[model samples]
Target: MTTAQRLPASLTPLDTALAAVLRDVAAVTPVELALTEALHCIAAEMAPLRAHPPQDLAVTDGWAMRANDLVGASSYAPLPLTAPPLWVEAGSTMPTGADCVVDAGAVDAAGPIAQVLAEAIPGQGVRRAGSDIAEGRTVMEAGRPVLPRDLLLARAAGLATLRVRRPRLRLINIPGGEATAAFIADAARLAGADVIRSDAPGRDAAAIAAALDASADLIVTIGGSGVGRIDAAVAALSARGEVIAHGIALQPGRTAALGRIGTTPVVALPGAPDHAFAVWWALVLPVLDRLLGRGRRRTQALPLARKIASTVGIAEVTLLARLQGSWRTLAIGDLSLDAITRADAVLIVPGTSEGFAAGTDVDAYILRE
Candidate 1:
């Protein structure tokens, strides 16, 4: 689609814009990777190759013996073992004919003979094979992101490698808006993408087209989405592919644009750091999450410390701070970097609502950084 219009009335709703950007997006191809290198990657498939422990084993350092042989034994009258006691440590395999373990402290070993003062029970202090993880059990389902703690389970299951999906991203800086390129790239990397960055001066259409032609799964361009004279992202995008959205009904990010260059999705963000930051999470993050097979963001319901107002038709994105065990929207005249840096979470005011009263419960998306 060509640059048909650029008016505020033409802006799309946040939800509609997100749907358009992600309608055709899919997870990247999966590949085999070493278990150590699969952190934050999405698992294609995972299963245990072997059962943990692999056999019945002792759970404590004690003497292994038949439970029936130690019956009726007590501190008053101990039962003497006919043969040498079989010594076993924790995690050691249980010997044949051994069904229980007597604590070492409760047994007196006088040379070859041993005396047990307590009765032992069958299956006591023993861990059966497959108790922790059964062979061929599913460790993780396809499209689930791998976490650090998952590696421990995978290692115990005897998995040396895993199949994962890691999407590649291309970032472009338009003209004088090179300041936030690195920051955006870092955010993309944190979202589990390999990023390649380029700079296009004076709304260079050729540079933008060249970046799109790269073999990246997604392309992101900073700046050049506004109605200003220097704005050429819309033109460049139309010249090469389709512009799905030219604007969104969002504060500090109304100029954001979404489109596609062939099969690769392209996102155009505003130049300002705060605007780009807000828009990236609101719009770009969904695309990345879909391509990486990540789950939805976890949110917490918190009461507002103060009233927050917004325009009737535009969605306002606000930063939140935890104060006195309550969340308050960061009220700033201009959406600046300093304001965002002081916040701990993100609060969204939908376009249908004009404002929220103090003490109103709202869902806040936790910010890891």
Candidate 2:
């Protein structure tokens, strides 16, 4: 009899397992790199300082003068503005002797001398330095994802580079191209991680041992990690390292393995694109945080719109959708099929359900953008 076809890919079970496992896999990657290169790095703590205007800057093109000069001046009894104040354009530095600036438009220009018709409030027309941002203030807090804007702020604080968590990344199939290593290298580039070239000695105990001896923050294995007879990844790790998880109960991706290579954590993932993609977001990411000494992180909640049938005794990470204000099932297991990321979040059918009906409310685990 022909074998029954199972669904392609999923994230739920793997995400749950990762959540549990990353807690135990502890280490931290501290990196000091230029802000330009701090792509995937996140702020480890709030910046110790904030940026203030280098000096007193102007907000508008106005005349700098003492505030008391315009107190009695009004539209009717316009004060004869004299040489005591200086005429300057917008963005010019505030003169040391001047206390405030009057908007050029606010002055009645009857001749070379401008007269003030309206009462000029003290510091009203000027932007004071240190007002928007105070020095020595904490700007970015720990656990905040480093984004382009955050980097911009860091630069403004007179920082060209920042101390950040070194990005942790693993790509299976790099040496063997079992699944496709170069593709992962490309994706890692998009994710802001520089791909570290790696290889398993020869896909067995001897090979894995030698590679483990090599310097690497993360280990990437391509192919050879499955229940199948030729799968040597599990056997190799069995010699020196224990498998944190053997089979994640998710189809196609069930072969995905998480374990240690010597002291360094290793990820043995399916070579397939969709399976690898799902595991990358659900497992590898959080595990990276653990390895880098970051506090734990979890996916934000998005509502589930549809029910999905999952295998009994197995956890299902259903890939679902939210479209036109309703939740819909997109696919079962493999989301990397060029179809699934269309949805905002993935539906996590807990490991215990057999299947679900339409309109089932389940947890939707979000992914990093």
TM-score of each: 0.86, 0.79
* Most lDDT-accurate candidate: 1
Question: Which lDDT tens digits does candidate 1 get at residues 1-369?
Answer: 223326456679988888888987888888777887787777776544678879889999988988999889999998888888898999999999998888988788865667889998998998878888777776677776777877888887777878788788889888777778878998887777878887774565555555555478898999878877567777788878998988888887888888998898888998888889878888888898888877667677888898888887788888888888788777522477877778888876787888888899888888853
lDDT of 1: 0.81
| Candidates' C-alpha lDDT | 0.81, 0.62
Root-mean-square deviation of every model: 3.5, 5.2
lDDT of 2 by residue, 173-240 (tens): 52454445665566555544546756765655457555543255666566666554445666566565
Cα error, candidate 1, residue 28 (Å): 3.0
- Give Cα distance to truth, residue 177, candidate 2, Å: 4.0
TM-score of 1: 0.86
